[model samples]
Target: MKRTPFGAWPCSIARAVDLLGDWWTPLVLREAVFGVRRFEEFQRHLGIGRNVLAQRLNRLVDEGLMDRVPYQDRPLRHEYVLTDKGRDFFPVLAAIIAWGDTWLSDDEGAPVVLRHRTCGHETRAVVACAECGDPLRIEDMEALAGPGLRTAGTAGTARTAGTAEGEPTAAAADSP
Candidate 1:
């Protein structure tokens, strides 16, 4: 069956999910973030199928998140390195790790912990406002209508869920 492409969705969350929703992609990214630059190292650490790993690496390179740089000239071996775009994704992975550590960890506790290099202290991931440095919470946020919202025949206005006449708001999914 063909998967629905959420990349074209109007929502940023949907677009992000479309790109990073796959099981292996995030793990591959995690490996990269951990400084796995060579193909052999990634394969050895992940134990992923060669073809699948190749595909993920290629996609990441094509997306400008990684650069495929030739490291050896004799056999033309190339190593993957994260671009600025790829490095920026580390925060997202940290947030995921934090959530898993909180809600899904075993009794042994989190398999890993993040320690700040500068402060020399363990820290938990938290999404904060760029300008204010305050933690972002759902209750303290509002989703305003953006320029990308479809508004051809209607006046430009933000509509809360259940407030839009004749429009249906999505019901919560039973499982994540």
Candidate 2:
């Protein structure tokens, strides 16, 4: 089935979703973040078919998330290394992991524990107010319009998570 392209959407989230494509892309990225660089390694870890893995890697490379570097001089083999943009995606992944650990963990609890290299302590990701460093809570916030808000198209008032189009965004000055 043909998929709608969201890269042109005014919302950054939509554009990111379009670029990430599907489960394979993020899984591939997860591996890349964990230092899995080569094609064969990604395949082994993900259990994704060769063609599909190739496709996802190529898309990531095309999207500037990963760089294909020549790793072997003899066979011209390459490894997929995360670019700066890709490395920057860690927070987003960390947020996802945090959410999963909170709501989706089974009887054994979270499968992974993230540790800070500098502090040498295990920690979970936290989404907080960047300006004041307060943890974000839905009740403590309000939605506000943004410059990209499709103008009369919308600067919607919904402070809800991306449940619908035109969800709210908070500005530094925004107060509930």
The most accurate candidate by TM-score is 1
Error of 2 at 45 (Å): 0.6
Instruction: Please give, for residues 1-176, the per-residue lDDT of candidate 1 as tens digits.
Output: 98899986777798888888899888988999998999999999999999999999999999888999999999999999999999999999999999999999999999989999999999989999999999887645545677676543334454434344555323322224
Give the winner by lDDT: 2
Off by over 4 Å in 1: 150-176
Candidate 1 local accuracy as lDDT? Answer: 0.84
Instruction: For residues 1-176, write the lDDT of model 2, one tens digit per residue.
Output: 99999987778889999988698998898999999999989999999999999988898899899999998999789998999999999998998899999999999999988999999999988889989999998656655667777463765554544334553454422666
User: Model 2: runs farther than 4 Å from truth?
Assistant: 150-176
- Model 2 has a clash total of 0
Q: Tell me the TM-score of each prediction against the true structure.
A: 0.85, 0.84
- After TM-score superposition, what is the CA distance of residue 167 in candidate 1 from its true location, in Å? 14
Residue 92 C-alpha lDDT in model 1: 94
